[model samples]
Every structure is written in structure tokens, then in C-alpha cells.
Target: MIGSSHAVGTDAGKSVENTFTLDYQVSGVSQGTITNDSAYTGGAGDPSPVIDPAGPTNFTVDRMIDLAVTADNSGLVVPSNAQDRILQYTITNLGNDHQAYSFSIADVAGDDFDATGLEITYSRAATDLNGDGDTLDACEAEIVDAPLTATVPGTAAGSASYTCDIPADLPFTVELSGDIPDTLADSNIDNLVLVAETRNPNAWAVEAVAPSVGGVTANDADGTNTITGLAENVFADGTGTSEEADKDGRMSAQSSFVVTSPDLVAEKRVWVLRTESDGTACAGEAVPAVEPTTEYPTPGACVLYTIEVTNTAENAGSDAENIDVSDILPENVAFVSATTSGFNIPGTLTFKKADNTTNCDGTAGETCTVALTGAGLAAEVGTTDATAQLYIRAIVR
Candidate 1:
């Protein structure tokens, strides 16, 4: 059977405060009841999840791979007087991400660039390094302005390339070019630097060789003679400096000097002053002779005469006298090479009286004889001349 239960509660109301009371109890044991609380509150707080923007991607450049130059890379051997040469450069991208690079050259010491005629050129190409199916138009090229620019279609990860050409003058500076972009990370993108040397083939040369000097004759008038030659080297080494063309091409320190004795004559002797080079003497093909006139007399004519002989000779003399004639010989004639006509022997001779008489004295009926005889006669005759003339000679041992 079902049983019922009941209970009661009270609520109070007062003058100062009002209150209500009510109570109720379950009539039978039954299932628990469910209640709904609608007016409940909680604390305030931040939201659960948030979204963040992506960061900038950094580009990495591997080595400036497969760098190359199209010029005579073996090295430019230019003449010192030649103009500049043209050079080309090629650089490939061996990096993973797309990258940019720049190029520049150095104006080295003893070199010049940026002249009016100097110039350069550039180009680019993009190709896959591996045999991949990806086709990327990552090739860009431009003239090397102050800021060089080149774009590769695909990322620089595989096969990106660049090329440049440079022309120079005056052996001054070498041209450099490459694909390096101006970016926030790197402001200067110079990829390569090189130098070309110059040479001078004709820098040194011989300018002149002196002409030969003529021979001189020895005479009593002039004592010393001189022979000379002049040579010079006027070429330069393109640098305004003198350089030696050959090791032994210089002029010798000493000049040349010479003296020669003259040829034989009737009562006169001759001497010569020959020219020389490097101490070697040179004789004239023909001996020079003095022309005789009334002023210069012959030997043994009893005429007024003067003798002139070069100082180089010690034994120079002449004889100008008539044998058989009583006339004293001219003073100009000294005993050089002499001979007698009336004497028994032919030799050097002196004039004397037959009987030691002074003033051309001799026997009363003997013609006042004066003649040469004996060894003294031969010695005197060898130095005496019949023609009233002077003789001269020079000897150098």
C-alpha cells in the first residue's frame, strides 16, 4: 500500500522587517528530483587561442660556383705602349634560395680605369644543374651600371649563371663583372679581381754611331794631334728613362793618338801624324809631301835656307854644299845623308884647309884644297847634302 507523509514551516513578518515561512515533506520514497539554476555567474578572462603572422624567409648563397672569365685568362701580356684589353666574367648560382649579387673592379697602383674609352658588357642564363623536369626561367642580364642587376627565374638553388665582358686601354686596369645584387644584407657585391701586366720590347735602342775622323800629318808647326769619335743612345723605355740596349754597347774610355816618321827623300826627311781608333793606328795610303818653291831651296846651292823638323825625331840633319867649289855650304844644311864628288871615299865629311890654314887657306899652287876622307868622311857624308835644303824626320820606338 502507498503511504503519505506531510510537514509544515512558517514565515514571519515584522514592522521593521517582513518574513514568510513554508515547509513541505515528501509523501513517499521516490526517485531523486532534478533542479535548474538559471541565475549563476563566473569570473572574466582572456580568449583561448591566437593566430601569428609568418616571418621573413632568409636566402643563402653557396659558393660563387663555376666562376669564369671569357678573356685571355692565361694572363694579358700587353705591350707597354698598347691599349687596354677586353675581359668577360661568368658566375653561376650554387645556392638553394633565390639570391642576388653585384660586381666591381679595383684600380690598382700603377694602373688606371674609368677612362673615356674603357667599357664592359654582361649577360645571363638559367639552366638546371641536375637532370630535373623543372623548367625555371631564372636568367636575367643587364649592362654593368653603378648597380649591377640580374634575375634568375627559379631559386638560385640549382643552375643560375651570369656573364660579363670588359675592355680596357693603356695597360692600366683590369675589368671585373658578375651578378651580385644590392640587398639589405650586403651593399658591396664585388665577385672577382684581376691584374694584367705590361712589357716593353723596344724600350732601349741605339741612337747614333760617330763618324770616322781623317788622318793628320806630322809637321814642325803642330806638336800634338788628337783623334775622337762621338756616340750616343737616345731611345727611352717609354717611361722617359734611358736604358741600355746591349751590355757592351758603350763608348770606350780612351781616345786615340799616333805619330809616324816620313818617307826618305834626296836631302829631306818626312814625318806623319796618323789617326787611330781604340788605340789602333791607321796610316794614310799615300804619304803627304811638301811642295818646294823659291822660298824653300834645294841642297848644295849656297842659297839662304831655314830648317824645320818635328820634335819627335832626335837625329835630323841635312847637307847642302858643293864639293870642288871653295864656297862654304849654307848654314841651313846640316850633315844628314851626304856624299863627296872629288874625295877618295864617300862618307860623312867636314870642311877644312889642306894645311890647317885659317880662312880657307891652302898650298899656294894646290887650289886650297878642302875635301872629305876616312871614316869621319863617311859619317859626315851620310848626314851631308849637296842641295842647299833642310831635312826632317820623326821616330817613335
Candidate 2:
């Protein structure tokens, strides 16, 4: 029965109007989850992006490691006669970075440290990492190879120290070895350096000494002879000092020694004693008298007298002695003997006898025979040339 009530509703339905509203919440939307499925699915999108942990922070080195040597600050001091000396050294690491380092020493290759005269040993602590006193092989290593090695604790480094025995008489050289990663990174580090020092001593020296001579005696007619030892009769001329021998030491003196044997009578025979440093035979001077002393010549007639003279050159170890005789033949008297002693003779005169008949054997006192030749002999005779010397032997009788 849609009768009367329905009639009112039909009219309302015919006049009714309809209205609609739409709203959307996007907050719930997110990048689609990425599932670990073997095959790709069309509905979901790619997963969320990811950021990698920052790469290792730029590598940093707070400070570089350094190596240095410490020993006798200025240098080593050695005694004059010292044969060997000990030298010590401390190696330090001045750096902030932990380092692996090493050290070594060797003669500069072809060069020599003169170990022959030196006694060398390494400190036990320097060689052993555990500090159990032991020699390190690195201590003996040379420049051509690696020397010391150690892994320095982080931010701190250890020391590799050693000692060397050097010769006081000679020179020495030192070198180091090991990896210096920072300074020389690519290949094995080969840095070559040389060190050295010297030692020497003082010296002493001596010089030659001279001697002096005394007067002599003579006989009037027959020949008289006397002998004397050079050492006892002679004295050193200058400072009679002695010294030790050294590098540039020296000594010098005059080798000339003198002798004076005189002529007493006009026909008097005289002979001279002479010897060499080696005690060898020598030549003699001869003279002849114009007037016989028996004639009783006038006072200032330049009385003729015969005299003999002898000279001996000393050997390396010997000295010369001067012998003199006087009283018989006064000054300015003419000498007729084969030799004249105790007087100065000029080179221009014929004083040396042709046969040297007046020459005396140093060992024997002999009479001299003489004959006058050339212009009659002139008196005053002496050696024009004088030689300074040292004598090893002498005879006084």
C-alpha cells in the first residue's frame, strides 16, 4: 500500500539532490620495501639508500723520527804512548711516531778504521733486545749493509747505543745502517757517512858537543913523543845536554881537533901522532932547518928548526884531539924537520912530506927522519882548515 503515505514520499524523492567529498593522507607512504625474493615483483619499489662509514681519516704522522750520535762532546783525547782507547756513543730517537729502526758501523769499505790497533766491543744492552748483555751483529755491520733494527713503541722510540775501541796511535771511521722508512721509503735506505779522529805524541832531541885542548912539551935534540886520549882531555863545547829521539830531532858540532908538536933544534927530528874517528892512519907535515942549533945562530936569525905534524880524521863514532909541543924552536924560527907541530902553516908552502917520513904511528912513538927539499922551510905552522868532531877513543901515555 503505497497509497496516501507513499504519495508524499514520491514527491520528496522526485525533488532530492546528492553531494560527495574526497580526502587523502600521504604520511603513511614510504619507499617500498625491497624483499629478498629471487624474482622481481612489480608492485613494490626500490629499498632505502645507505651511507658508507667515512673512509679512514686522512693518514696522519704527528712527528718524524730522528737519529743522533752522542759521545765525547768535542772529540777523543789520547795519551802520547797510548795504544788504544775506548769510545762510547748514545743514539737517540727524537720523534712522536712509532718507528722501526736499526743502526750499524763498519770501516768505510776499501778504507780502514785501523782496528788492528784497537780493541772493540759492543755494549750487551745495545745488541740484545731483551737487555741480556750480548753483542749485536748490527754493531759490526758496515755502510754497505743494514746495521740496527727496532720496532719503536707507538709515539715513542728505543735507542740502539754502542761503544768502540779505537787505536790511540792511528785514525778511525764509523758508519750506520737500517730502514729509515720516512726519509727513504721506496727502497732500502743506503745513506753513507764517515767519521774520524787522530792521535799523536811529543818528541825530544840532542845536539853535537865540542872539545878543548891543552899545551904540550917537547925535547931539544932527539925526538920525544906523547899520547893522550880524546875523551878525557876534551870537553863538549856547547851545552852538554842529552835528549830523547823524536820525529824531527837534530844535533851538530865542529869536528876539527888540534895538535901542537914543536921542533927544538935545527937538525932535531920530530914526529906527530894522528888518528881518525875510526882510529885510522893519517898524513903528516914535514919541515927542514937551514942552520944547525949547534952552530949557535944569532939571536933573531930566524933559527932554523925541524918539526913534524900529523892529522887524523875521525870516524863516525870518533872525535879529533889537538896535541901541541913548544919551547925549542922559538917563534919565527925556520923549521927543517919533515913535520912541524904546534904552528900555523900556509897552504902555499910545501909542508906535507913527499914520503911522510915524519908521520908517527898512533900506537908507536918513533923517531922521524927528514930531508930538506924545495925552498928552505918557513917557521910558524898551523892548520888552515879546522874540522869539528866527536872522538870515541883516546890514549894518554
Candidate 3:
């Protein structure tokens, strides 16, 4: 069982030999000494069976290098336009012997958006020096920033992008910091994968600054040319959920960031006004009067609908921009007029029919698009309020 419990002393592809020595008497007296040697067969003074050679057997020990990366917890929830969001992870060495690892992170495809200014860092256990239960005070630990190199997976011949000195069967905490893009919607997710590759143990010390062709280029393990008495490296890392390939001296794991932004809700309410046969408007309730199943609007009745877009202060730091909303009139209803309010300053709201005209010409089944351009809406935070209302007047055919 050559595993972490009983690790192999010799390196992989190295030979291990054993021999035996015997000293026995034939009947009553001593028969001298006879040491087993596969190359010797009863030469001058050497006494043996002479027919076969005895033990001096040897075998080669193979190397197994593996590692694993896992997310520390669930996905991190971040705010829009946030910076330096921290994502934590753990890297464990699953090999029989101590290993040096190089780390890098990448944005995974098929996600909502890519995080900006990605950086790799080291995280230590939080300490409460102020006698508090949490490490929120200034006495707590800070993240150790690791400088990134332009070339990933491979650095200088004797260098790496980010290296960690990890012993066998041990786990190290790593962190990734990134900035969230501006104006991202709530519930949007961006996944990032962290990759750790096994580097040459020899290069762990005295890293030079010279470009190299590939990582682990010096004294690398050769599966085909495995010679005895010389240990070599062999990749045994398994494929991971983050699309990390097997036996490539690399392992990966993924974590995500979910955006938590202010909720922007739009609601529409409608009312009715009685009219004459000549389409002349008559007296009616100023507010929404007709309720479903209670009272229905008659032919040529004036219907007034109001659509309100409210930027609720559900989550903090969530301001919106480039707002556009469209409402299509149903059958048997002719479009009359439309207007907007609550949009001023740099922000301007405009309403247009499907044909991009200000007037809809009393046409049924027409779509009216209300757009707020220039400066977009801001959430009702502090003293600022961002709300827009669209009013439409339509008539039943």
C-alpha cells in the first residue's frame, strides 16, 4: 500500500533492489557463509547450487501526482458596479509526496458576463485580536496579493505565475478577486474556474526570470523511458467538473458570482369614461373605474391606461440606464393619444407607435414604445427618486 499512509521513499521510475545472505551447516559443522548474488555462480571459493542464481531482485517505483480544487462555499452574491469581490476556494494535494503547484484563473464560457480585473490571491485564517466573536475589526488578517505574469500555464524556465508550497495531504486556501461590470441586471451569474498545475519540484527554489516553452520542462517524468534508480514525475490528476483534462498535471474547480441589484417594477392600470354615439366624451370617474367582472366598457368608451416604471430600493447600489418599454393595444381598441411624466433633467421620455410616428391615427392593434434615453433611471436611494409614468388614451371600437 504505497499511498499517503506509507509513501514511497524513492522517486517514480526509480529502482528498488533487495538481496539475501545465508550461513547454515550441512549436518553438524558450519558450511561457511554464502551471500546471494544473481551474477555469481560458484566461482573459485564461492560455493552454491551452481545450477541457478539466487536473489538480488529489484523493481521500479512509479510516481503519482494529483491534486484537487474545491469551492469553499456557495456562490458569492455581489452588487452591481462593485469592486474587489472575493471568492474563496481550497486546493488539496492528493499525491504521495510533497508537490509545488502553479495556479491561474479563467472566465468560463456560457455565462452571463465576464468579470473584470481578475486576480489571484492567498487567504489566511481570520484572527480576532480584539476579543470579538467575528474578525470584522482592523486586527483581522488581510489577503496576500500574488502578482500575475503575462504567460499563464508556463512562466520562465524556473519560475511560475503563482506558486504554492504544498505538502502531501494538505489543503491551502486561495482567493480570487474581481470587479463587477456596471449596469448588470439582478440574478445574473458569472462563473470562474481556478486551475492548478503541478510544477517541477526542483524549480521550487531560486525561480529565474527567463521565458520557457512549457511548464514542468525540466526533469519531467517520462512514462515511456522510465529508467530504474532515477525517480521521475507522472501526472495522475483526474478530470474535474470545470472541464479540466485528465493526466495533464492540472486540476480545476469553479465558483460563481450572482448579481444582487435593485428591482425595477413596471405596472399598468386602466380606467373607462362613458361617451356619446358621436364619440364625444361624457362625464366619467377620474380614477380607474371599470373593474373586471363588475362593469364592462361599452362601445366608443374612452379607456385611459397608466404604466408606471418604479426603481425599487430592494438592493443597494443598483442604478439602471437605457430603459425601454413597449405596450401593444389589443383587438377592437383604437389608439388615441399617449404622454409621459416624471422624466426630466438629462433624462427624456418619448412615446411612439409601431410606425415610429407620434400619432397613431386611431389604429387598432398598434404598439406604443415608451423609451427613456440620455440619462437613465436611478433608484430611490437617499434623496433621489427615479420613476417614470406612461399614460395612454384608447377607445373601444
Candidate 4:
């Protein structure tokens, strides 16, 4: 067909290359003898007639390839000692041929709490947030999380205690899906995540990527390799002279990470439980302890001490240990009926939440006290408001 072009595996009307050839000869009588000689060369509707016994123009298909990659750092936040912190990235193949990509990582920022010691993993292909397009810029969406962290088979999801050594060396691969150009013309993204148990109680960022460490190679069904010498940085449109245009498709990204060691804080409050001329009152209803007006509690006035403990950081792997709260009652305040809430004191103590008013110590004049060890602390604090705090109370003479 004249003026038509064809690409490998492309439909008759789809290929844009000028590779179609047309040849023919005249068979009508000429001076009592038949003279047949004609051939032509053309592409996309431009065919030229050549005198033959002469020759038809030879046509060659033009192959092209281009690749570029980048990372996404939008609204990404991670806490230290966290099992795994995921970093997202988008890869785009700007070439005309379908491709399979290899991956690697570059610990951009190195320090005492670097991700080098964490279990670094690359996720399987993620759905394109931008749609069926080759470049991430073509679509609009915050590519932050992996719907399912299943990238490499057999690898369960999550980051645990950081036991990995620094200078983590990892390599992975992913082959794209789809057989048609339109279907194939979509962005291939990855859920590059890092898991660690230990990190400096500070803030930092880490980056990783998959570089084109090698060249491209493939064979056509017609029995000939149409592409060669296409290095990692290839430009189908004439060797993209500058290496930048033909980069080996390497993309890396960084995410904010903060190692927050559990910090324990406390708030101690006192209120006058009741006022008796010489002693205490009924436990059913007592007045809020007023700040002692005198040096200490008067003859009938007593104090209700409330202590609250809070763990000011989110912990997944290494949690706060030995969380305890204690206050030796005033040397002369004497032990009175005490009530413990949200705590498990040792010695088969009645672990009650509220309204369990009973003295922790029986001594009438000696220093009375309330104490609970690591295991006795009920609902030990964590970062979330749900787990971040716990409290206890006691009454003393």
C-alpha cells in the first residue's frame, strides 16, 4: 500500500512508521510487445513511482525508547521505632516499546538513626492514581499509600524491631502487564517501604530508587532484533545526545521520619476530701480537696491525691517499660481509706476502676503510699489519646 507505515505488532491503520512498500508493472501491449516496469516508495500517503527494471525504495522501521522516574513526597509522615515507613514513587516509560524494570535503593541521608538497619522492601505494581498514562504528571492524585502492601510474594507486610545492619543492600524486579499499547501506556509505580525497630529519637528522611543499571534487548517474531546498543539512557529519536534525556530510569523519594522514644510525664493534683472537727467524713461523697490553707492538713481536713501518667510518643516495637507512680504520704499525714482506680496493685489487690475507697497502708501515723509496677499499670500510656494516658488516686491523713 502506498503512503502507509507500519510498526512491529501494530495494526494496519495504527503504526506511524514509513515502512510499507508497493511494487507493480504495466502489462498492456506496447509497440506489439508487452513492457512492464514500475515500483514505488512512500509512507503515510506519499508514494513515489520508480522506473523498474530499476528498483523499489527500501524501507526501515524506526524504533524508539525513553524512560523517566520520580518519587512522591506529599503529606508523608512516619514515627521512629515504627515497624515500616512506606515511601511512594512513580515510574514512567516514555518509549514506544513495553518494558520490565529492575530496582535498587540509595540511602540519601545517613546518620545514627538511618534506615540502613531496617528491612527495606519494594512493593508490587501499584494502581496508577493518575490513570492509563505513561507519566505521573499526566494524572492528579496523591500517590501516598499502597492499597495492599503485597509486592514480593511470600513477604508478609509490616515493619518490626530494627535489627537489620546499616548499608542495606537490596535488589528487586517487576514486569509490567497488558499487551496493547493503549493498555500498556500507563504509569508503573512502587511502594518502597522501610521497616526498623530502633532509631535515634530524632527526625530525618530516607530515599530509594530503581536505576537502569543495564541496556535494553529484545527479538521480533519476524526473526530479527530491531533494537541494539540502546543503553540504559536511550532516545528512539536519534541517540538523545545528552545523558539526562536518556537516563537509565532511576527514581528515588524521601519521607519524614521521627523516632519518638516513649516519654513519661505526670500531673499531680490535690483536693480536700472532707472536713471533720477532729477526723474524716463518709466516703460516699467528699469535697474536692482545697490547696492546704495551712502548712498541712488540719485536724479534720484530709487530701485526695490524683496522679496521672502519660506516655508522649507512639510506640509499636519498643514500648515504655516499668511505668510506676508512687507518693510516700506525709510523715504525719497518716494512712486513711484510699481508693485506687485503673491500676492493678500487687498482692491480690482488688483491681477496681472507681469507688473502691480503701487505704493502701494500714499504719496510722507512718508514711502511707500507693505503688504499682510495670505489669500492674493498667492501660499504660501510648501516643493515641486512647492509649496515651492512665491515672490513680489516694487519700491520706
Better of 2 and 3 by lDDT: 3
Off by over 4 Å in 4: 1-63, 109-112, 116-397
Clashes of each: 53, 57, 1, 18
Which of the predicted structures, 3 or 4, would earn the higher lDDT when compared with the native?
3
lDDT of each: 0.23, 0.23, 0.60, 0.33
Q: What TM-score, to 2 decimals, does candidate 3 have?
A: 0.47
Candidate 4 residue 238 Cα shift, in angstroms, is: 15
Point to the candidate with the largest lDDT: 3
* Best-performing candidate as measured by TM-score: 3
| Per-residue lDDT over 263-376 for candidate 3, one digit per residue giving the tens place of the 0 to 100 score | 455778886654422233422234453443444577877777788776644344556676676677765677666666665434655556677767456656666555545645
lDDT of 3: 0.60
Off by over 4 Å in 1: 1-74, 80-84, 110-116, 126-397
- lDDT tens digits by residue: candidate 2, 1-397: 0111221122111222222222223576644433333233333453442222331122211111122334421123221121223344433322221112222232223321222232223222222222335534342223122223322211111123222211111112222212111111111212122111111101000101221111110111222221211111111112111211111111111110011122111223322222111122112211223323332333222222333332221112112223333322222222333232333332122222224543323323332223222222232223222221111111222
User: What is the C-alpha local distance difference test score of candidate 2?
Assistant: 0.23
When sorted by TM-score, best at the front, the candidate numbers are: 3, 4, 2, 1
lDDT of 1 by residue, 279-379 (tens): 11211122235442332223222121123211111123322223222223322332122223322234344444334454232123322223332421111
